[model samples]
Target chain A: MSEITPEEHTQDTRPAKHSGERYFGWTSHPKAGLYTFIFVGVLAVGLALADFFVHRHEYIHLAEFKIFYALFGFAAFGGVVLSGWPLRKLLGRPENYYEPEEETDNG
Target chain B: MGDTLMSLLSHTNPGFIVILAGMLAYVIRGEIPRAVVTIGGPLLGLAALVLHSALSEPLATLNMMDMTFVLYQVERVSIVFGLAFLIAATVNSIFALHNKDPLQDSMALIYAGAAIAATFAGDLITVFVFWELTAVSSVFLILKSGTPEAYKASMRYLGIQILSGVLLLMGATFIMGEYGTLEFDAFISEGEGLSLQDDPGAIFLFVALGIKAAFPLLHNWLQDSYSKATHTGAVVLSAFTTKLAVYALWRFFPGEDSLIWIGAIMTVFPVFFAVIENDLRKVLAYSLNNQVGFMVCAIGIGTPLALNGAAAHAFAHIIYKGLLFMSMGAVMYRVGTTKATELGGLYRTMPFTAIFCIIGAASISAFPLFSGFVAKSLTMSAVGYEHMTIIWMMLLFASAGVLEHSGIKIPFFAFFAHDSGKRPKEAPFNMLLAMGIASFFCIWIGFPFLGGTEFLYGLLPYRDEAMVYLEQSLWTTDHVLTQMQLLVFAALAFIVLNRVKLYPPEKRGVVLDFDWVYRRPLYHALVWTGAVWSKAGPAMTGAALRLSRRVYNRIEATFSPQGELSRGPLSAGMAIWTSIVLAIVMVLALIVGPH
Candidate 1:
């Protein structure tokens, strides 16, 4: 609802003032980044702890290992993200890879 | 009055009300009136569905072409899909409320209506009619973008959709020919519903649904068309077409073993494409394909619990996927693009959209308390119970992949990544309302405390089986712990990768998909053929002319009156020889006749 234009907004790459600032104020703060990391790490570990407390009747044999899901989740996600590098190398064409000349026209 | 109302409702096709509202919307000019009709149509259709839900049998049948067409079947399977379709229609209408285009509004309604209609269809002929209607009506969503690219993409989308419809009809024909009926009921074997064995017709039907479902290589149409659609059009487009195919597959090919491998491939490949995809809408399209794979695999498992899982997942998926698309649509509406390479720091200006997108992402990623967890658990457990070790592993891999592409990448890149310095307005109030509603359901359905799991379970076709599984397995400490472990660790992986700067940066480019075969090489090949023909045509024509002239000259020399027989002395000698031969023959004939 604010009447501010893109031009009028401050050029600071940090947080732009909005209601989002009310909730996500710390995201822009460099020191708070560590807190965010810690929060996630603690949550991941706590869930892993549940592995010891909760006995899972799993279908896959590998799933019975301690924190198996945790390790698998971490590895699978990392693999997908890291695989992007190679995939891009193989599949990445210039911006106009599909329609080479059209990008310039649109741009 | 009550009796009369009940009787009237019995004959009414719930889907027709929505379609009629669409038709009515075309005639209205005012934004408020059109919005009312657009939103109200689905609401009324939802009401019709509620009114008709008590009737388990076909509420009414049409005698057309000497065959009975069930216009309104309100069985458990149809009810689940029907309800989901109605909810999606209502939500999408709200998302698209800001757009004043009557064409987009009407087409969206018609598209949704056709899907709902097809859902309630008890016979193949009825399914075919609505199936093609969905194809024809939905293309305008892409076309309404009014871009040349969108126009071309719409044509491609339309072509594939119509091809699916054609194949479906062909399958129906074969089924009818073999079974002496086109009723969808023909496939039920003693008690198992619609099992596809070695039937040739079922294979055709499977391929048709696969095309719509974007089964791996057949998936290019979804990304191509959806990414190019008008902002609202994309939101509306996301809800119906592919999910309809999923419903159809659930109906027809449940328990077919081939679906297991096909579904596994579906879940894995899209994750990679989505990772590298530049268009946010296109990424969601890939994510949609991946999610459908889970449902498909469950259907392949064909157990009661798995089938219930597929149905529940479809119901939930329609809402979440639509929400994700709406969020991206809002971004495109405000900023004129959803390319991740060009978008960042949008949460500064578009906080609500960002939040909704995250909710959608979490739901799709199967966060422990989201809608996906409740729905997907049934399938995963069914897989485990069946001892399909390898397929289960592939599904596990896909689970992590979903978190990577749809769950994390979407929000991280578009809203919170490196600031691209693009400040856009928050989405309109109507779009926010739609997203808000969808996000609420995303959380509501999966939270065990919210009773959504029970409500959704009650709607399953195999209700007793689902409830038994629910009682035994749904909220076990082990299941919840494992799910949380899987999802949280995936999040941990993303954070670590981001900290290490190992995540691939989004860039502008078209990654080649199967569409490249048709859109690029096949098109270019045709163009090349045309060019070759153009270049070589005249020379070949001239050579043919020269050869004909030589043949004409030879013919003239050999048989033409003026060229040889009439003008040359050889003709006179030949005539004299012919006369001598004839005279001798005549003499021999006279002697023989006398003898």
Candidate 2:
């Protein structure tokens, strides 16, 4: 096994000199995000439509309503993700927040 | 002689054999020999577990200090957790094949062995022994990172773990005092465990297990240590400690009521923390907390189906979570950090790791046809059966939360988000093989008719309940469609959020957690107290010394013979008065004293 020094580890993050090789380049295309969003939107709509046709035998009464899970999932996930903005503002610290400064100062 | 040897092997605790192999690995010189012992030990333990004679009975016992210690007992629950541990140990050894650190190899095996041993222990004393051993042995993995940060984190980790072990010992002592024996069979019966309210020891045991299980507020050691451990060390560390706690919880406090709320809170709180976290491994640490919450909740429900759910989820979680950690470990191996801000577009080079990571993400997210879906269904149904609507809703909300951080964020930011232009090489072959094996189990157990679910369900404590659940509810149209609806909408929400710029971008920072209360305020308080003592201690001591000296000088001036009494020669009047006083004292003594 080869040992990776800290210097080498930092250096590895830089773009490789031999940059010709590429795999899964399509994922980097300009419109990939748009395409992904459209695909997921279509799937969500389709699933919602399927919910009306399928009978849900639910233990909780509110879940029997059509597209309840769809709404709940979308709202719950979005709520959690959007909460990140305030969570970060409230809790975020510098990358070196926890590092002991005395050691570095003495050295 | 052959028959005797076989009998010894059959009756011996598989963990001891694995521990012996670990000791052998320490002295072994060659790489191949060490690797053989490291990987082969767990395999041999699995064989021993299979060959053990019976369930719910002690296969081996020892008489010590006028007490019988049941050292090796195979129960249905034990087999589920033990098999998973042995498999994980082997997989972890394979994953670490490239790193030839002998100490790590030995300690990893020993840590794993101790957990398995504790799982099979029928008496609390035996459990306490291996419990501390697991804590002592596993700290070496974190120390192998060899960074100041890793050192600090490992010490904190060790402290918390040892505290948990101390609590367990205290609880065991209480049990021994209350009951004449400490054996599970003697005190706790088959289906029912000790009640937290009814027994003093149960509360101690609950808190002890809660700490190890990373119950809500007591969970910082996990995120702190796991993110700092060596890449391979994180993978090994993830497999044992908390799962052992869960096994203990199941053994001792299956139906405790407070665990229901504790587990619910455990599931929801980490999701919020994980969302804003930058380090991908730390995100997974939170995700691990969330996943375990489901099992904890299931155990709290404590019906046959729920217990089965807990066991089945643990078995599946040990594999998929290990796979996730292994994938990240591979990333750390080539890239040196798992922070999301420092990683992206590596899927171009490390495609195999990306695929395996996605599989693991999907499994953890409880996608249809995944191990998590099959395992978690029983718990959900059991909760529903009990009509615990509020708790069920909390779990449902947490399920979507799992999809956000683990299912989407891990793979997205690390592999497919905006290109960071990093082109590190693909993971080593051994790592890929380990991940491949784990991925196989995820799909095999998750998909129907592969005999994987059957095998897993068979190992569950309540096989009948699990089998019934598998047949009646698992693949039902409503269940499948609703799950699909939940997951699809959740994925759609992610897309929508990203499109609308609502999704938070990965940044370089640490998110503050409960650890900050200690790492900041408590730490500063101690430091301040020390500084005050350093400044004031000598002053206080000098003042005390000066006061004592002043008193001594005063005594010498006033009462010493040279200072007062002998300064003047005895006057005649004084001598006459002294004689008169002496005569009066003699007369009083003679009058008052018994003749």
Candidate 3:
């Protein structure tokens, strides 16, 4: 068995060389570029909503548009609920919840 | 002439072909080519589909208590499901080609055949028989993993499945007693003008269907068992049980009001769980729950268009979901695991696998021009037609949620997201081939003029309305834009969340879910039951026996002729003399009264 075996359930799991931060495949990314993406995504959504209203039908209900606000609010609420309570527990370390125990001899 | 004709006629039964082939394969294990065994199932299914009407249900009775269970019915919905099961069997057998477990291979065929037979069953009895067969046949795949966990999971799976069949039998018994027949055609409670909810056995039937459908809290068995099975076992598990539940739902409760809300919740809750789930297979199981939610909602809608959507979604889901499972199975094969946190950077070598996984992910996420696109849109549109604003938005949100996990997280983590520096080899040829066919169907069904949509519609409960909706307003800019916006913002959310590092970092901890309550607490309860049952059993029985013995001894001592009562005969004689005097007095009084 590999070194990282959990003792109770006897199944072999592939060992991780360095788990604390395997860099999680971020070796190629510039960390600052992500901030650019966040900014651009927000700007793009805002611009698109504005364009849809102003260009599509020429109808105006900007003051009475509570529906869209409610929708976004619920979406945010759901996203938080999902990530806060369950995400950590649900997505766990690796598939080997059980690993083989080391061999021992009494006889 | 009679002998020749009879020999020609006996080949019409599909059951014979399948069981015969299974026997033949086992006998000719080393002699005959493997392709013959591999090709045997679909060919037999096709031949059966063609000649079933000419032949009778074999070794099965349609004649029990005036209830004839027709083993083969060419109904539209059954046709769709049966066909899907057949195709899935072929695909699955291919995926398992490089694999050599005789138990898994044989059990898979038997399970597939049983599911098909269940689809064609004409009576509740036939359905029950095949239903049990499916449960029994399927556990081989799980047990073949040879892990203690696999054994436990298979036992749980088989237990739940058989329990479901028992409930079905109980309902069928009640149904048969009330109606005097087990034939599965439409029934209106014998003579009632309207089959009211208060009808004697309707609730029992509904509960039975609800369990199989994985309604809300009853859903965790799926997440638990599917996660623990062999890679190929999980794939085979997808095609049968829940869809069979769907077939029964369509048969029994087409337009029930409660199913609508139940179906809506079924679609929604799993999204949260899917988002947080660790094992990719389990995540897909939750996603599968959410998709089944759509079908259940359609079943609730019970409109022709909605029913079509339900059937079509089940059809499309089986393919794409199986595709996802197959790809993940391949990942599990190469890396020896499929937990998202453990799997990454496999894209370096398994590009084709990555691509196929992405196609499955996209199809399931219901991206425009995917099979899920054409099928799921019908159900959502049906909700809109009903003016159910809240359910509509929830389903729309769910579609986005689907994309985040199934579309992005699955392939992204397993293949690309963060390379774990594990340079695993590519998937075996058969696994890739299986994924490819499933992926092809995802496109073929979604693309225009592919006859996939038409073929699907042809097999729906309500065909005409769904076809018209598909023909009209399907491509309108408003509809497309709305769908695109929901998906685009969802995609944007995933990207933004990832960029800002707000997305939950893949963690290595057990996430408690509804299953935790059952898996742990209920497990404890069973242990307690066993403890209590064993602890109390002897004392309870001993106390009852001792009390009975004491009562019997007292009766024997007091009333026996040779005992205390016989010795007291003198006292009894004195009492008799007193009674004689009283009798004389009463007689004298009666004489005086007459005078």
Candidate 4:
């Protein structure tokens, strides 16, 4: 069976370029909270990097526990992504897994 | 003699609740019996608990032919679990008032009573008897759905559950053979957590309890049956079975090192499944697995602090999870679907129920002001203090995952996701009320200033830290902000992913897990085995029978009356008398040996 391509995931073909909800009771913020989030994200990532370098005794090497976690993280992320494929159908049930049929249960 | 009779009348056992429930099932037309059993049976249990606990003397031991076992033990942990169970049974009964199915109500009560009875059991043998009672009573709730799948799933569920019970008995029997006593306290060996070295029967019992607790790969029966049970059935099932296993673990396998890793894995594996799962109930089943994982990990930690954490988490989870189930049950009652894809915009109508669902979500997510926040922090701190960095990180990861699946996805998808345009009516008043009470627990337990939080901490394994933890660090601004940061970022990820069309939408097919091995392939394997058995096993036996008959016919012709063994009175009488004497000897030996 054919799978939906990632290219088709985005729906960018709108007549108007719409802005999100109004910010600070003035104008719509097309990029509101975007930079703030990015800044926080970068700082967090940088901190993680700094910790890895700073704590070389703990970080330069893969701890036994980290191996399990890295493995799990990859496995879980892959499971989610691959689930979108027809592979999911192998286990998926119809929405009516337990529904009583109208005619059968009806008096 | 009069006092003895009075004691016996009020005491709890496997027989009274089930037989009474069976009678109640026979009499009540619909909701009344369920209401009575759900609400009234617990009060009966509390009275029984009082009777047993207050008996002044130690619980009377009973010796039945071969096995010697205590009728009850009123220890502190057992008391807490029993009280929690009593409360759960009552709450469950209330939550189930909207259910019109009597069989569900009856079976639920029997199930609850079995759990309580098992908790009070002071010996392995007594626990085993009531343990299987739990299995037998619960299968009906799954079967009560009256669908073919429910029938099939419940049968598989019953088979696995009964197998676990038999395993427990096998372990108990072995323990008795080794120790010459059936009391639970006398189990001589404790495995090194998951190791096979420390005890023979302990590992078997651990695996059996692990099966009930939904540990890792052995946990398929939960998702298999919980996903298929009736709306009320799911709630009833959630409260006891797994928690009982956690209790068993605490009692028997505390300090076994293997549990730590196993519990960590248990906590993590279900999040991905919960995130992608389409069935709302199944998602909760995964979430339930995740919650149980926390308890299992704590039990594995095996410190008093950790054990208390496990007990506390089980207590808090039963209510909030039931509340979650109640809210979902309301939705299912009104609209007849628990699929996330088919549900949305329900808050506008079922506002009260929706609010309850949100409360459940928040409590489970360990939001700073919920029951989960308090109970869960103990385990996290325990692991941290022990310097198990990996476990600590895994738990933190799981906390974020919990936020994604339970805290956000549950309420977000079911109540506030893209509108499905189905304007179902508000859930029944009783259902909403059940949700309301559950929500109250989530709040009451979370507020540290409130004595409820302090009281829970007081009951911890490390009571010395109870006051200290509450005052100093439990609600530190830095800690709260860090937790919020993690949870909020995870929520942000889910939102961004959803908005960008990257979040996995609820799909129309089953996600294969360990259950797929059993439900689809093994189920079909068993069917194939049945076909093979019908075709091959009996036919082979039949052919052998025919060949034996032919040989016997030839011999009979030579003997003129019968086969060689039956030929003469001299031989026959001797054989018969010998067999008779042997049977008598065995019977007399058993009768004369014990008691």
DockQ of 1: 0.61
Q: Of the candidates numbered 1 and 4, which has the greater TM-score value?
A: 1
lDDT of 1 by residue, B316-378 (tens): 999999899999999999999999989988888889999999999999988878998888888
**lDDT by residue for model 4 over B38-99, one digit each (tens)?**
57767666666656634222365688888676776665567667767777777777777766
Q: Output the TM-score of candidate 2.
A: 0.90
Best by DockQ: 1
Off by over 4 Å in 4: A1-107, B1-37, B47-57, B60-63, B188-198, B465-468, B526-595
Q: Which tens-of-lDDT digit does each residue in B1-595 have in candidate 2?
A: 9788778878988898888888888889799999999999999998899889888899999999999999999999999999999999999999999998889989999999999999999999999999999889989999989988888889999999999989888898999999989999988865588887777788888888999999998999999999988898889889899899988888887887887888889999999999999999999999989988988998898889888988898999999999999999999999999999999888888888999999999999999889989888888888888889899999999999999999999998888888788888889999999999999999999999899988998889989888888888899988998998899999998988888888999989999999999888887787789789989999999999999999999889866766664466564467778999999999999999997
Give the top-scoring candidate (lDDT).
Answer: 2
Best by TM-score: 2
**lDDT for B399 (candidate 2):** 96
- What is the alpha-carbon lDDT for the whole of candidate 2? 0.90
Q: Candidate 1's C-alpha lDDT?
A: 0.86
Better of 1 and 4 by DockQ: 1
Chain A (candidate 3) TM-score to true chain A: 0.29
* Candidate 4 local lDDT, residue B555: 77
Please list the residue runs of candidate 3 whose C-alpha ends up more than 4 Å from where it truly belongs after superposition: A1-107, B1-28, B31-34, B50-61, B64-66, B186-196, B525-548, B566-595
lDDT of 3 at A58: 10
Kindly report which residue stretches of model 2 are placed more than 4 angstroms away from their true locations once superposed. A1-23, A101-107, B542-595
lDDT of each: 0.86, 0.90, 0.72, 0.73
Candidates in order, interface RMSD in Å: 1.3, 2.5, 7.6, 7.7
